[model samples]
Target: MKNDKADFIPIFDGHSLAGWHPVPRLPVSRAPGEPSPDPDDERYRRAMQTTGKWTVEHGAITGRQDPPGCGYGGYLLSDGVYGDFELLFEARPDWPADTGILVRASSLGSQGFQILLDHRRSGNIGGIYGNGIGGFHGINFTLDAKYDEHGRPIGLRLEDPAAAIEPMTPDKPALLDDAATGEQFLSRWKWDDWNEFRIRVEGASPRITVHINDGKISEIDTEALKHPLYNAAAVRDLLGPKGHIAFEIHDNDPGMGEARWGANAACRWRNIRIREL
Candidate 1:
């Protein structure tokens, strides 16, 4: 039942590079004695400086946000563009942090999908962010049965049927087909701690599966729909074969009430592998 076909391949298994090319970290405009930036930092600032990129430590890539107006506060990236591939990584937020994985990005802006990582009740985990209607791509089709001592679902939340019915694109709309519902079931079974995330893309559609503590949590089929944005066709044409992959370290203003940001966020990753299927 698992779709194994993908265009991109994995390069690492834990700390070892499985066989794929490892993206190099570019320098940014951070002050001296600051930490090194992640490989994805080259895209945001237009040019590489040493400010917001993170270094690989203790297994995961960490991200930091620059001050406001310093060219889009978070780390920018422009390396390792992929299409029709599978990506796997593990993210752990710092108590209350916000971050995401951006796919199909371009210099103009992010025109693809985002896999968000926020621990808020209102926001759905393993969902898409900032493509007009927020979190539309993140279809919460399932729920986990386990609950904490406080009776809350252990690392999982029930689907908001109202949100699921919202339209993704005006023309394309959103479809909660049987496959999507199945995906929700799996996602609800995930664990709370650091877990593995599997994202598979084929042509215009992508599938996501999460493994919490080495157990399958959820898997969603995203092949029937077109891209989330209206301009996706043109952007895809411009990208040609490969698309860019990036990590978002969003910023927040103290005055902005309860808006989420990537404050105190960090993660570790190993065994990153991809294959062109």
Candidate 2:
């Protein structure tokens, strides 16, 4: 049966990070036109020192971006790579927090789609993001739109380019139980409680599906990825067929900056499991 329990396997033991590792830091550029810093930069070392903050507590893996100890946040990458699979998990986020799970990620930078766990008025839960590749600015809420072979968004473009910094807006939520629109889904997301999340990915063209709290949210097929949708050329070359799974701790704002999340803006995950399809 589709609802059978044995189809899935636990990836997080609820007590230890036995199969996960902190992602290596990528080179950062201090300013435009300046050469990017080496991977061995001091910032990378400082970031690694903070991995201890990602702790397994009360049967949940919790990440806290506390400054002075760890502020430049990064991803907690899985030691293994995955292709076609369904991942089931739950997350509780502090208001004004930004986090996501990266699928098919490469070590250099997150290379696949990031299911957005953004929890702020300007953010969208269950949004699809092309991490290191594609033109979507990582907050694509419209799902039915199709792209051309060149990656240009052709059929329907739902959102304007995301603002450099998401503006503070009043919290007026809409029902998401049977959400008819992305805005509804965003509104229905539980901000103060744990919410269920799921993702499924498959095929060479890479079709992705996202669900939040058991409500169907977003879906995308990347076969039509084209220019304007992201740098199609760079995506084709950098994005691989399969890679690791990782969780993000977005450092800066616009999404969920350290300032917004505060010194201890926390994001918690539990019941993390995946099943190959």
Candidate RMSDs in Å, in order, are 9.3, 10.1
Q: Could you give candidate 2's per-residue lDDT for residues 1-277 as a string of tens digits?
A: 1464467899999999899887543433322233555657766666565442578988988876645224566678888788889888889876546678888877744456777776543456675666656425333343222357995423322334354245322211111112226555745566467788878888765677777776777776666544353544445455567778888776653444454454667788999999988
Write down the lDDT of every candidate, Cα atoms only: 0.45, 0.63
lDDT per residue as tens, model 1, 122-142: 334555443321224544432
Stretches > 4 Å off in candidate 2: 24-52, 66-70, 138-164, 167-180, 186-188, 229-236, 253-259
Best by lDDT: 2
Model 1 has an lDDT value of: 0.45
Clashing pairs in 2: 134-230, 135-229, 135-230, 150-226, 150-227, 151-225, 151-226, 151-227, 152-226, 152-227
